[model samples]
Target: MLVRCSLLLPLLVWLAPAQGALERVDDFALLDQHGEFHQLSRYRHMRALAVMAYSADCPAMAEMAAGFEDLGHTLSDRDIAFLFIDTQGLDRGQLRGLELELPILDDGGRLVSAALEFGQAGEVALLFPERLSLFYQGAAGAGFEQTLDAVLAAEVTNSIADSIRAPLEAGCPLEFPVRETMLAEAPDYAGEVAPRIIENCGMCHRRGGVGPFALDSHLMLLGWSPMIREVLLNKRMPPMQVDPHIGHSRDAQYIAAEDLQVLVNWIDAGAPGPAGEADPLLALAEAPAPGWQLGEPDYIVQAPRQDIPPVGVLDYTYEETELGLGEEKWVRALQYLPGDQSVLHHLMSFVTGEGEDFWGAERRQENSTRRFLDGYAPGQDLLREFQPGTGVRIRPGEKLSMQFHYVTNGQSTSDATRIGLYFYDEPPEREIFTDAVSTRFLLPPNVPEFPLRASRRLERDAVLTGVRARMNFRGKKMKFAYQAPGEPLREIFSVPAYNYGWQPYYRLDEPIAIPAGATLHVIGAFDNSISNPNNPNPDAELRFGVESWEEMFTGYFTYHHAH
Candidate 1:
């Protein structure tokens, strides 16, 4: 069973880099209640190693017994090794009554417990022994199931497990008698921890922002410490995390190792605030400016105020306004000013003809004209500007159709968002255009990797400015490529991992020039299996549809004619 024990450990040494936030568990051995030597090295061949920190005296441990038992059966069938380590200093007499059928290793010295640093009962750490790294360290809950599914997927695909997957443990705190002696210094909230939170969390977590709640004071942070810790450890708070090894984007949100340690350490050390100290979070300047970042808009189109109910589903709202352009106008840039940013989910604007609703007379206007002018969503507030010699054209008497998608927050509110456009005196040398490479495919149920492809041949010499991908929950990965005649296809951009919630338009650093006959290709795959944590139903056969619940495969491309 341990044939490659020596070779694998040394080969997987580079899996966990020295500077990462990953807290690797040291290998140790212990005798189970049955006097069977359960060693860590002996389980390297398994898909994963699940270690449950159990305490016979803790009531929380007893409450989690059913969950642990269910997980043991599920993991064993999936080829995952599971075991329990007793952290409490309970004697055999006290444990005999519990009658846990699972293998319970006695950690009389609390050596294994201290090494994993699980503070509470019912916490489990998922380890990938093949890589000699910790895949997930968190409490047993719904989040644990999601993490386990992700681990299993990674195992099947032979992909690297996410380094940060520790959800906050929810259980009675274990009284590690030696822990009190180990904490000699308390982390000051104002001096050490506040700066870190303000830098990383304060932007979205402030009042009237997109965050669910505020973290503007020491008291507020303390009150929400458990949630904050959970999001931070699980790598869920700082959204749209890009794999550092794959590529780097300015929009990527990643927490540094040193900063993460400061927050986690302070929370673990009892979240102390110095006596009579001023709140740093309150003292910090507000991040969002009252006015536009690009000074003032050349022309601002104010959208009609929308009344959002406290609850229930809401349909898409459509509004139109006449631009009344006497002559052609060249728009250089555009920005969205959302009145109630919290309730606003997304906004899509299109330049259509007179009396046109969402779609033109044909009812599918997107196919008729390159009408999708701009879009706005959370964390996608960057000012959209065309290339130096390119701009979007607005003809005389053209109307702007606005489509709003709002999500209720259990409160009655309204939004009057304004679309700001900056125009140039003269038309640019080239006119920018937006096109999409899309396809419709019926997805079979429980298919892990369903490949799809779509391509469009260019009609004119153009420069590819940017690319963006759109898909529903089943979307896994997408890449954009172009093939010139008599030349090999070359991938220009790739979204290795696609999260439905985060769809940012990635701008190319260097624009690619393509001839009129070049074919642009968009290729991707979908995961409709049970392993997909986001899949609404693994058994439901999905088809191409316009609703969010349904599936769609489209890759948006922004380009301009090379006049």
Candidate 2:
């Protein structure tokens, strides 16, 4: 026998006829399965927005799915944005298995479900976003068709649609059993919630850290609760996260489900701070400063001061500093020190030609053929040490060029970032080289998933020490594989869920060996449709380019050629 939680009693009691003026539905945002952010306000240009609360387990969904798809077809010509939101904690794997025509959005914590007051699975809510009012909230059968028709014709204006209450549909309750249980005993903030933040977010969210704001106090956290909640539930925080089932990395930051629930539940519970409780986060803020993890360096070089304006986009700041090396040098490890973490998007250094300074196509003719030394981005390991005998070589006269990508943080500031290098007493037996495995492809406008491929054949035996995928907002996923002499191709590293915000070098725990003649292949795709939230202009045909808004397909391989 099917059972339902009793929490639906109060929810049903509050349900009322949609005959009078309806309250404006608050603006909300959620990421679809395709990783595109869909905010209700962004779709105001549409005639109307149809949001359906969906679940796979409900038997009624089978009956309603075809109706929802049909409604989408009918309204597509009318400029109505149709979306299905998944309230259940469904992962990408489960979502992929479901037969869903409409893009399925993952609302991990049911935050949107609670906000919209979803009564049951397969409930359809029609909203007139321009007027900021709920047009109709009920079943999608006859009443939805009527409202959609009326809204499409001149019958129902934005104001008139608010007063039409569609009849309710019978369906299984969308149970949020945890909310009821949490109500009995609220999650303790200091004991349970704060510790999660400290463990998962403290590394970069503390004072002098890269995070835009500090999360070191109860008051501070409560103030930023809304933004924090959004990023966490959307899986944006603790960047460099991967699908654990696909691959594993020692540096990957995977937050436990229970820990995430504790924080989100605490925020949902109003973020109350008990009286007389000492703040652990505040105490952590006073702990001793974290010195260099690799100790004092052999040499340090700082870039020129980069003036950042109060607003507007700034082109990449390029500066060149001569290493003044008398002889060849071997750098075992190096670390970057960003002058201003808030605005520094990333810093890239290269061993460039004598006059080739910057790293964009617009800057120099030789920018595409330069040597990549190292780079630093948020959450990436800055102080990277090479294997026992392998190190990055520095030619005697090779100059270092720094390209700074600074994002505006709503404030004017300047930066003089520095790089610390530790050299070995003697050159290592093997030297590491960084090269890109990429191909050129055009992405048509409004295309959802366009496949692209790039490969390189090993000229000499080498160990693939690490790999980093490079793509702008439209990049979907990148996988690295190698086909050995007589063996089937095997996957080495895969960024199945690529995020433009965080691009970290995924170092292999055990480097894989590739003999000469083995081919290393890179596979990925691009999402250049309305579904890609990060795509700047889905209507614009995009080709490979250096600008952030443009698109590119490149996979960087870090390997040491065998002697």
Candidate 3:
């Protein structure tokens, strides 16, 4: 059975439809089995988007898939994209076992299924991207083709295609345990829903946080439930989240499938909120502000004051603050205290020589090693303590260069961000440096995924402590992998769905060991197509550059040579 969510249905910026009665469906995105991103809204160029809930284990899957392929071939010339959604959780390799031509959207367990209320395999869904609504959803047969035909019939009217149909019960029943539990008893806001929000989302969605708005109270959740549901279904929130199955990163946390089910199902259940004495989310809101996570600093350096306007686009701000060090300093740990959390999007620091700036060696070469102190991104651990006996060495005459990126929050404010550096009582064992695997290429205009690769062979043994992906608006996803001499390749960290907005330096939960002669690799691609939401201009051919407007594919490898 498929559940319908009609009450308190929030509409997101609906323009009058050009054709057909507007049957509205909110926009969402998902990755196919091939690691390709597919967003429904971006398919406006297509006449129709054909999709079906697929289960490889289902008995009727073969016949239905064959018919779907036939129908796709029939509409080969027409602008129609046919895809399949995996009702059963299938990894890329398992999906490849099916050997299908069409991309199977690998829905992370049951998030998309719960969103569309799909409980059966082989259920069909035809969507009109222009109207942002479903044209048809049912079993794939005569009725399915008829619905699609009437949709593409070029002004021939049929009321059947416009109305929503209850999902047919012919195919195998896909079990959504979470949805079933919710149907039995709605998730209590205070007991289940709000606690999950406080755990996974509170850090970023609170007061003075980087999120667009605060999710402070029960009323707030009610207000933004639709947007929350949309982002959850599309895997947009929990910013800078990497693919959990591929690699492990201390900085990345993909909310558990059960947690996602609770939130989305709660939203589907009208995001009901009843007072239970104290709201957990409100507790997060009323809690003390972000203070020095690593306690007081031995030394503090402040960046220049930044004046942010109420609302508009802002460029990166660069400032250099001389440490004026009387003696050499070894920084074992550090943290950044942003003056205005709402506006200060990100700040990066580097230990450079007298006249150098934030670019360091990035501007001069495709690959180089330098003293990159650290970077600050939203929803990340503020305190960074280096590995035992390792420190970033700063000479007496060195200065700290910082790059500031601020986003306006509809309010005028000023920020004087400060860095707290914790030093070692005695000199550390080894100095830390960041090796970059970067490349320069001319990305073709309007290409969705322009493949790029960069690698460096290690001449000496080293331990990689952290990594950061540096790409501009068009950055899609970058992976950090290594192959030591004859050993098989191992992926340590990956920013699988890289977002330009949240650029966190991923600290590996387990540091990777690289012996001499090991080759490190950075494999990634840029999304210059219209599908990329952050792309400023998909029409322009782009090149590698230092500025944020241009594109750069550099994966920073923070490491220290093994003793």
Candidate 4:
């Protein structure tokens, strides 16, 4: 998408931009005109990414577009992706008219524009995604080709920095009104940036939380401003990487355009200390942790303790806990209290028969419906309460199957987790159910992206409440979409940059209604290559397995019957 870097860095030499030198550009993401998601860091498979600053108001827009199309064809064989960025805010309706084949990034707020220093339309930036180096910055025609040729020549010489070019002041100048205003007046630390941090990042970035550091003071903010900028630009923090252009979710961690503008602007403005003594961050950082968000549950089930080793990879462990329920109950919500969050990465729970495990019908069948309680990942809310009238029905003799996956954090620990079950006094009007859509394939070794799709047709009318994507180490990305009998395909959920460490069950803010004869689809791919950061071993020719070490593609749809 719109990955970038801006001027201003003293301590972090890696982020500094020297005159006539190759500058380091941070990563960012944005949706293109066709609703396709693109992120700079995700394109590690490519050698470089070329983006042109575009504005419809510019007079040379037509010729530049034509030349950019030619460059796209010229660089088609090369491992470079061509993209266009919109400095002026334009809706999809306005952009659809241009009908450009390239991904015209939606830079509505000018955040990425300001970060990348896109001062003029028709200006081009050639970026090396892996190294985050800027190879060239100049006008998008002859100079662009010359820089590309120089960069190619340097590849043979094994000297990338030698081919870098300085910025050329030729093109239609574009205006960034907010950046001008922000640059003029320093951002108020107490008023502007701290509140945004408290709201968006305070959850995990606190003292004892999972974050690497705590933002308890303004000084801490000032010290970690560069890293904060890095993570935000890369879409790494906020930890929830769902595309906002698609379906909305309450749990989706989204910062407003204005808020993002304020944050980066404040950071860029030397990150001055607080003008006033009042600091809101200290209170949130020192606050006591609350428990059982919905209050004490009707019944609490203790899971068997798992002993994690000091170091080494571990497969998925499955254990079933006997409920010993004398009577049946209508379950409303379940809360998972992880005993050891440091070692325990994530776990999945399911309501199963006496002898069944978490795999249930998934072992023999590629796709089947199952009873899914919850798929708990890091940074997710521990307490999950479903809609008022909808709850999974639990009967006597049913057991709770828990699957535990642990990641060693240089320490030995034992995790004896517990689950709090909230039950409805009476049977709910509607019953919540889950449909598991999965696929099995022998993934070839060292492949950058191996595409996979899994789909299942609905037997009747159903209202989809939530969706969860499941894959092992090599998982790259996954999207959930559906199509009715006569309607066009609609995307409901998307994990644009999937992280195996953060597989939180995404609950949609608004549920989608699907009629009978509709087909739900799960589209995704695996990156079994060195480009993938989380890939344990790209050379492993793996098949589907229940263990986290092996690979499995499964998309769970949580829905309720309409009738």
Candidate 5:
């Protein structure tokens, strides 16, 4: 018989009406290892649900699975249900042989996985049927059995839970003590502050992070707390300078204001807290694994391996490959996995008919640029699935050209790059469009200031949709604005303080409306003197070129026109 836990009672009661936590999980369904459907409702009658988020091949997660199996055995007679969900699109076949005694579900879509707020590494949530509530949640450590026992003892009642029956009030007020606490009350360095740090700083500060060290454990945090506080107060940890009031959007690795405050208060209080229970949240199961998020790719095109000579600045290099598509092929999605993610800074992909010079086209003439299928930078996820019936097409005998910008790290290395292409036999519903803003201006040497501008007028009435600007460290400010044939101009996007390392493609929440025959303008300012820290040559005369040291003023726009 199922021994239901009181901790999950609230979630169960709330699950009935579908609101808040309950509502968030109602439509959740995921594909299991064998591509079978796994619905949350199927396990509704179980005493409790143990939800675990795992990555495909993370070493830390694989080791923790052994512990999870032990925990499952401990609760086997308690009628609890254990379900493992792979958060990063790893295939079941790859993970089939693992010695686990639970059903592992694949959350490739990330719908249910994200709804649970599952962090990157191991995270666990204990559900109670009595109040339909989450009794315990945290990363892996001790006290798991203690929390589980308490949740199981809580009695289940028929009264509707607040999350399910009651209308959610406006956001609840959060309270945190402002006064600093003494070191005696300080929480264990790992137990209290580790979770907060993992959520906020782990993404970029980890080994792969642009930072110098990884904060994967409590010892690392305690050692680096002083430096962490310095970086936070100085606003250097997160390297973007966007006016929050204007547009504060969510993305991977974004830290919330409240979370930031928690870090500040903890650091101010000398990071104090009582010894609570062990963290139930484990690191993402099977994390730090390698493989495609969407399983194996249908086709892989590897770039000719090239060695990076030790030392000196590296210029942009172009490598072209011939993908013999017998006929026009509709590309639904494409994934580019870097051979050496550490050294490869950025890559751009372009498609052209046989023997056409796509890059040369832009170099030879002003106001000249070719269409870009898609491009990727670090920390960027694959493009959202293309709209139904809409896909990028590559004609037969066309070449897939790639331009890679590499920064050497005093090591001799070669990269065999591969791009996975997913195609459809039929035409897509929507078409891909690219509009570029380019200039034909030159900059003189050692100039204190220079006005560089580029503008383009729409030949026909078209929507001015997504906008992204490109520039190097010498760039000061870039703004994209539009003026209708006879109307006042409005600025759509602006980067007042541009940083080359933090280049982002900013998409408007809503498409900006532009009238027919409107002119789109791109205004950019450059700082070529010693004042700019990123200037490669403060003394060299700067010219209009594609080189990073040289200046190029360009804005890319993606739009959809009425059929």
Candidate 6:
């Protein structure tokens, strides 16, 4: 019986290089349960090998393990190796305790899974050495037995299996042919590109940046050398909306392709030494004071102060205040400065009519606060000036509402928030629009990890676009793509390493061109088990809600409708 194994592989392989059949696993070293090293080339000479990806916590995988063991026993006489790969995000300690009987290899970095196209968690592939073909492929269910039988009996040597496995050798070509471009003289790293990197990528890629690794120094850059080149060439790094032609820079995360090429070329040139002693990056730094990136504000709106207890997970809290904007004012820029920066993880603000308050709503919802006018997170500086023409209008008698989600670092703390606004007396030429994309999905408690996606096609085509997505601590990855009316779908933005504490609105430098009927797709994956360290409750059934405690799938899209 033909089986479907699409859902069985771990989804992380979505970022792997494309390969045809018979692909050789690339160079990657990972540890096994016993802390032994497992290299990709170890199984190269085996006549037939079964690479089974499994997760100990997943019940479906536990059931599949039995079949895999049976198949291993059946294929034992044929000298075929049954190699199990653990794609669960477990460290060495947790993995060793599971006692999986098979020779399991840890693919914690996901390099092997990505190279082999075993994306789902419990998928199996029967590999043949002679022709380097995938003789059988399927999920961890009952139907996998047929594929196992076929592999043992040698009955699946047909063209389909041959086609699937034949291309593995040609799969990721080790060499990237250098291209001859207009600016081919290998751009200077420190001079030409480091400034741009500081401006766009550095804020998060630095020593204390929100990103996992730092890109502040040449040594660090060399450490992640190749991956940096690959992600940029694949348009994956800098993680911004790609529209190189139009749009005013609204966010600090946007990087231009030319800037990317400079870094790529710099890395390609072995990251040569800076041309002159006056370091460009240091020269460019207009470092702000200790507490704020932007100077003190014209107006400071403080939230009612609160003291955080030491040593426990604090429930979501909200504080409300009234900002009496006596008359209409055009805000050209704004900045949010936390009274105590270390404990403030994120803050959100909302504009409300004088009488409509979030305090009442919070009371109704059994909470203490109201909605916020804007949202800000760590690594996010105050809102800066847009192109001369654009500004957010604050009208008289309009109350500015604020909410702060504070995460403590095991320290007793008190926080009083203040926001500064830079106003423009004259109206601007351009306008900004902020719209949200959300989904309705119920998450069952303790059901191993699963995929969740939500999408909405634009009713009418809109041109410039920016997005903000929110998920509880368990979010794994999120992506925003656009399918133009008659063109192929293009991924505009993706957050591969999602952090609950630092959510930033990624803006496209060049506004994306969307046809009137183009559709926008937003997808996100959640890991809601104890294994997912950030999951507040390993056994809580999650459902749709706006509260910070509940799970939510929402995409906030700010766009300008075409005229």
What TM-score should be assigned to candidate 2?
A: 0.76
TM-score of each: 0.63, 0.76, 0.88, 0.90, 0.59, 0.52
Residue 458, model 2, lDDT: 80
List where candidate 3 sits over 4 angstroms from the true fold: 1-19, 32-36, 42-48, 66-80, 89-102, 117-119, 141-169, 175-177, 293-295
The whole-model C-alpha lDDT of candidate 6 against the native structure comes to 0.57
Global lDDT for candidate 5? 0.57
lDDT of model 1 at residue 61? 71
Q: Judging by lDDT against the true structure, name the best candidate.
A: 3
Per residue, candidate 6 scores C-alpha lDDT tens digits across 74-95 of 7776757777876655666677
Which residue runs does candidate 6 get wrong by more than 4 Å? 1-298, 354-374, 456-461
lDDT of 5 by residue, 110-168 (tens): 43454454555456655543234553454444544555664466444443333212111
lDDT of 4 at 97: 77
Compared with the true structure, all predictions reach lDDT values of: 0.69, 0.72, 0.80, 0.79, 0.57, 0.57
Question: Per the 3 Å backbone cut-off, how many clashing residue pairs does candidate 2 have?
Answer: 0
Clashes of each: 0, 0, 0, 3, 41, 27
Q: After superposition, how far is residue 448 of candidate 5 from its true place, in Å?
A: 5.9
267-363, model 2: which lDDT tens digit per residue? 7778877557888788547424434678898878878888888688666677899989888888888888778766777887777656565543323
Worst 10 residues of 5 by lDDT: 166-175
Per-model root-mean-square deviation over C-alphas: 15.3, 6.2, 4.7, 4.7, 22.9, 14.8
Better by TM-score, candidate 6 or 4: 4
Please give, for residues 1-563, the per-residue lDDT of candidate 4 as tens digits.
23333442222232223332346776877777866667777677777789998899889888988889788888887878899998887876677777887889877677887777777888888887777667666677566776676545445212323223445466688888887788678678788778889888887667655565789888788889988887776667778768777798876777777777788877877787777678867865663544787888999989999999878977778899999888888889989887876666678888998667778999889888887887676667888898889898777989999888787756677888889999998898888889999988999998878999999999899999999888888987889999999899999988867778777778989999999899999999998987787987888999998677789999999999987
Q: 473-524, model 3: which lDDT tens digit per residue?
A: 9998898889998899888776768888778777778787899999889999
Model 2 worst lDDT run, 10 consecutive residues: 1-10
